[model samples]
Target chain A: MHRTIVDADKQKLNLNLRELFNYRDLFLILAYRDLKVRYAQTFLGFFWAFLQPAATLLIFTVVFGRAIQVDTDGVPYPLFAITGMTAWTYFAFVLNQSGNSVIGAQEMVKKIYFPRLVIPLSKAVVGFVDFAIAFLILGVMMLFYCFSPSGNILYLPLFILLTIISALAVGIWLSALTIRYRDFQHVVPFLVQFGLYATPTAYPAETIINSLPDWAVAIYYLNPMAGVVEGFRWSVLGGAPPSDFAYISFVLIGILFMSGLYYFRKVERVMADIV
Target chain B: MSDIAVRVENLGKCYQIGHAKSGDFRESFDSWINKLRGINNGQTGESKEFWALKDIDFEIKKGEAVGIIGSNGAGKSTLLKILSRITEPTKGRFEINGRVSSLLEVGTGFHPELSGRENIYLNGTILGMKRREIKAKFDEIVAFSGVEKFIDIPVKHYSSGMKVRLAFAVAAHLEPEILIIDEVLAVGDAEFQKKSLGKMEEVTGKGRTVLFVSHNMGAVRDLCSKGVFLSKGTISQQGEMSKVLSDYVNSEAKINKEGGVVVNVSPLDKEGKWLKGTFLKVEVEWARNLFQEGINFDFSMRTVDRVKLFAFSSEKRPDFKDLHKRSKITLLIENIGYVNNELFIDVGFKYVNKDSYEALILNEQLITPSKEKIESFLRRDILVVPGFQYIIE
Candidate 1:
């Protein structure tokens, strides 16, 4: 046998991106399967993506806009709610689906050897398709409301990319944790539900940051979704750009993403056995 | 030098077998104490770690197909899992020179909602096959699996046999450098088993290394050139397939040789009775002797409560019996007509100090009447009777 000593200081894992690239067709097929099975028997099919955000916007606009009397900064409450809800819904969908992806594909994990990251990554990609459809609806709503955005809308892709990265970062950590402790599965949805209000999904970020102490605003901005929501709103609506606190949140998101990927790789080796 | 393709050194794996149900309070208390001590509290009292394979070291050269044969709980599966990287070793390491593909179980990578065509790509990808390679071999896989008509249907709708066929086809066709299969061939029907074995033969013929685990000795002999016999998580023997198999079987037979009497007899008749029309009692007697000396002996038998059933002495022998010593003898009555009820049959050998007896050697219990038919009890064909062997050394 060809023996090579494994150096402790050197990186043990050589993630072959080429190998993953070679399996791109398989990844696409899996992502397509997830999308197909999801809307297979449903009458609305892809429209359900837009419908979920639209329906949630209607409910939140009535509750927070009319009942709670939250300010929308001269934008129609429905339009504002739909835009933020679209991003939040994609985040929630990716979190929930990718959190359970490994467990859902336990058969594949236990039987074969593949990059375990493929399972969660495929779910994230499928969620992106949903996000795109919902974002289309938001674009139509923007047109109907006669709210023309400035040239800053070109940065919208960057914000969308940020939302996906954050979602995948948390998703990788959750997927790895859920394989061992099934309690994380129950904890994830509850966290997502509570996170809707915690982040500025329905209300403007300035409403919370302006009213709270500087320390509290800094602490609140540490949540990556806060930065993502604000960044998305600024890019799409050409409204107020994120302040220094949001930059710290961007740094925090990068750290979580890297650490989550590292932690996921470490746990990926033992998942077949422990799972 | 041997063309070694796989080398395993000091490889060991430990598994924690946890009780399915325990008191929640007891479990929590154990975890709390473990956490305070700063030990790994997550792996606590719910488990007791066991080394399935310990310090195992071996090597296999290129193009050598090895068979791992073992009894249940003999760590064969654990060894395969370690080699396949299905689980990491607790304390040890190994090096495999080539790409390893494992078929631990059939249909392992098949997604139920995906179509057969879709699953071929999915399973192939998981087996480490490239898209172009899968596309090139797609038709061959479908043809081998024999599910061309239903390739587009969801796999959940496929029969289990169909799924197994497709799974095996995908795995066997993938053409990995090293293949590890663990008892997957046991699931399919006989025809399919033959087909799978043929495919395995073809795989090995291509000069790829193969590690196969199975309990079927016949299949091991047929398929593998080298064999490793595992017993209680250790390699008991390793060599040519026939030699290792013989050693394994002989060791097992010798281990099971204690506390039993063997008798050679004709077939038993119907109604689960032996010698239905005969009236006779048969007794076998023997004594362990190291010295070849002349010593007269007598054989006797009795019921459980010391009621003598039959007795015989050296004088009963017709001729040439006086010249021998330390001899074993058997008393055979011509016909045992019927066993009236349940009885414990004992046999004893008389010596100078005391007579040692084989207690409760045989329980002649009559089940139902033998009057119905004689064909059943007439089929009692005893192949070998070690009880009749008189040991002189």
Candidate 2:
């Protein structure tokens, strides 16, 4: 015999992982649905996934690598830039998509009851698919550059995991905020634009971090993406290991992830009313 | 086995009515901060509390098909929302002894780009069916929706009726121990509606618990065994389906014998001057005991055949508030939506009672404006009746 109890109020937030697990099919379906809608009827279709980061990599190579002459140590510029762009593009896309996922699903959110977290998290899964496509493009560029990945390639999965968590942390926060204050809706695109220039996407992280002072360097790692982008480069290009300040980025990501979850749970309780 | 399928205790939902209507982000944020600082109590006359549902307690036994009937704003939907977990109540709790499936609307998650076949699987999963379960019922749902020829096409191209049929088919196939449906049977052609109603009767015949909310009296009478009538957020009557239906119809629609205002709206003034297009003047004179605050007056204009045309409520009028016991209300409605026809006017006054509004009285009036006077004054070159359909060639 099965029984379900519903209370008017919950005194504290419960991180009911078991309940979320029961709705796993919903998460997968939403992700699949988004992917289907995104590429439907377009002539290029799924290839756009590879083209976005690939095209951006070309622009960065011409503008930053050749025109500005940002140093890539000894590696070819396209190979060097694509690795960073791969991680950054996935982060930005996930953050932007998941940030608006709740608003985009106003119809479903207002009508039915499911784990609201499933909506935002599905964007994370979709982002991973796009990342895989762009990653495939990067592998061909690596072969073209005649570069072999180092033993550090084994640690690529850990860096990828870190990128996903950081993106989801910031994405969930912005998504919940968008519902309450639509100002965040306009603020998110600006954040993504400003974040692109602020991170070490155009140049190597070592180039900027090496010049900063002790205190400034410590503060620089507070941006979680700084370590992730550097880790992506290190894993693919066999360059210098991520700086010791990488530990600060890891801690920052953890704090952001926890607080993002807490803030989302708080706002989610009142979403049906306002949304 | 437990005979009780659902048990609700003291269920209540309160909304901040005034401020929630529509406000700019900055203003709302300021209000939130002021509320926290205790500088703004939020109990100001402008921002008052409204309990959409209060003190609702009921028990539904297994195999009981209950019909929940109420007029607009009567808390019928709010109760369903709480039971379906779409929103939480402010207080109390509920328990269910079986898997619950609630369909607030058909095609809740249907995407326009997805084909009918894909939507079947997608909507089936959303309604809490496993993939294997959906696969098993796939052919049955397709057969029921009867769009088999275009099953592979995107739903966007299908006619609206076809979309509703497919959506209803997916929803009705969900097998749960408890099913809650809300006004989803209004769509589709009459024959299709009848078929879906037949399917619902089949569902309840198997001894499953069902809670149905519908305005269709015939459908409710045919499907539901017990009935619950809600008036202003509280259960006013609960008993056999026929008894509750009669009570709701007689009280809400058949007019009240208790005191209410008699309305007189005229196209021509007392001086016999034909009034022009801009105003439909209604003068309501009532000399009765008045409630201090939260007094709402509603004026409904319906066709002579009893088809409702339009309704105007004084609750939205901030200026027409705080009135004395003996007074006359002269309303100047700009661009009234009407044609040259006889109409009936029903005036109703509602007041807050036990956190929800209860109708104090309702007065109905039969009005026939002078067509000759209105036509002579109304310019044939210009049509002043707002929302009236006109084809000028």
Candidate 3:
């Protein structure tokens, strides 16, 4: 018989990774429920998944390519924008969904006991489901542009993993904060809208990096999504592999993810009362 | 030591209410700014603190069904919540020997937009059941709920009774080592409640520990072998079910010593909400000057824990105007059911001058136990025919 301790100790800071793993089925189930519920009665149905990023791709190509004329580094602007949008859409989906997952599932959290981490982590599956559909649309765009992906496609999965991690890093922090500080609840959508531009989802990393001031570029590099989006270009579009500075984004993602975890665990202990 | 399923050591939970009730970032932010400006308006942080549970200690042996009973706000839910690990205690610790699942609600995570089949999977997994395990027990759960025909229909379409049944059915399949159930029994129809009770008994019969929190003292007495009485966040008494049950009833009687009325119903139906019984004793504390005119009592009975009225006495024409201060008014209510122990005892009369009289002072309702074991009274079944007995001072 295994034993479990319930206490008032405020110093317990471990992420309880084992519990999270044990609850992996619940995480995936929650994700499946979300995917099912999302398209249940909608006439648009699964098309909504493709519609969001495809629509955004069209808008970005027209606005950024036609008006401001952001550089695509010689690639077809539609192809460039769709690839970045694919990665960015999944990142944004995760941020928007996981950030709100805790507050959304407050009733479950207050009533049941499981690793609270499962709720937000389950949302990553929902992201990937929509991301898969968006990825298919990107494939269609690649065929339409007649640009076969380069051998770098092998690393596409790694970039996809990084994008999710990047979103989770910030999403985890936002979720805990949203419960305590509802200000974050309203701020999240605005943050997602702002983040769309802050990361190199629309313009190539090369185009913006050349124009921004040295310090501005350094701060920009801190966004882990930059590394993820750049990796996407490198893997899918066959660019000269991303710059060495790109590794900083991975390190930043690591630090943010680790600390976000600890902060979430710290908040989770008291979340029931607060929620 | 291994026989124990759960152990607690002086557990306590303190809540700072009022301020931050909304958890509004604006409020906290404004307060922080105000503090920076050396402002002391005190409107921002007017939080009052109270220990919802404190210095609580109890343990349940494996296979025991322990009932935790208390009046509302007496910390019953708080204690259960802590034990469920829904919230952490502020000052102590507890230990569990094995996996514990707390059914704080019947449909804890059910999504109305989803079908019954989907919710079973969602809710089962949320309660820590493996998907394969849920699938294995799938047909039994649906059959138990009697919602097999509507399993594919969205839960929102099912009647509330169907929903509760479906939810309870899923929870019943969770064979955790320790099952903590809140007052979910108070829902569903009388028959369904019995089914759920039997289900709980079956779970414990298999040697799993059960901690139940319910206001229906009768069900508690019947189902649980042990009882823990809580009052104002502390354990007042705990031991065998019968003794602790009597203590809880006594505590309710003791708290009504202040100027108020007490109602006594005999052979109380322990588990059934729509009760079959007789006799309601309305004893108003004779100290207060209640009225000057002749008082006519109107008795009514509602199902326990619900507001629906089953029997409302038309009016008692007996005039107790001249009855002395210490007199007890005894009015007979026919075919009366053991209710929530709530009665109108309409203590009013014809205003010696006006055409109509109106004064419905809703006082706190208390159940006064006559000195005897209710279980013994319940078995005789001879107490159903109760007549009024008035005592005059």
> Each prediction's TM-score against the native?
0.75, 0.79, 0.86
Question: Which parts of model 2 are misplaced by more than 4 Å?
Answer: B20-46, B255-393
Position B258, candidate 1: lDDT: 24
| Candidate 3, A66-122: lDDT as tens digits | 888877778888888888888888888888987779989999988888888888888
Top candidate on TM-score is 3
Candidates in order have lDDT scores of 0.70, 0.79, 0.76
- Which scores higher on TM-score, 2 or 3? 3
Model 1 collision count: 23
Q: What lDDT tens digits, residue by residue, belong to model 3 across residues B175-273?
A: 888888889887899889889888877787787789989877656766799999888988999999877876776466433332344443333234412
lDDT of 2 by residue, A125-188 (tens): 9888878877887899988877899999999999999999999988988888888777887888
Candidate 2 chain B: 10-residue stretch with minimal lDDT = B384-393
lDDT score of residue A33 within candidate 2: 89
Between candidates 1 and 3, the lDDT winner? 3
Candidate 3 CAPRI grade? medium
| Candidate 1 regions with alpha-carbon error over 4 angstroms | A1-26, B18-47, B254-393
Extract clashing residue pairs from model 3.
Answer: none
> Which scores greater on TM-score, model 1 or model 2?
2
True contacts kept of 1: 0.35
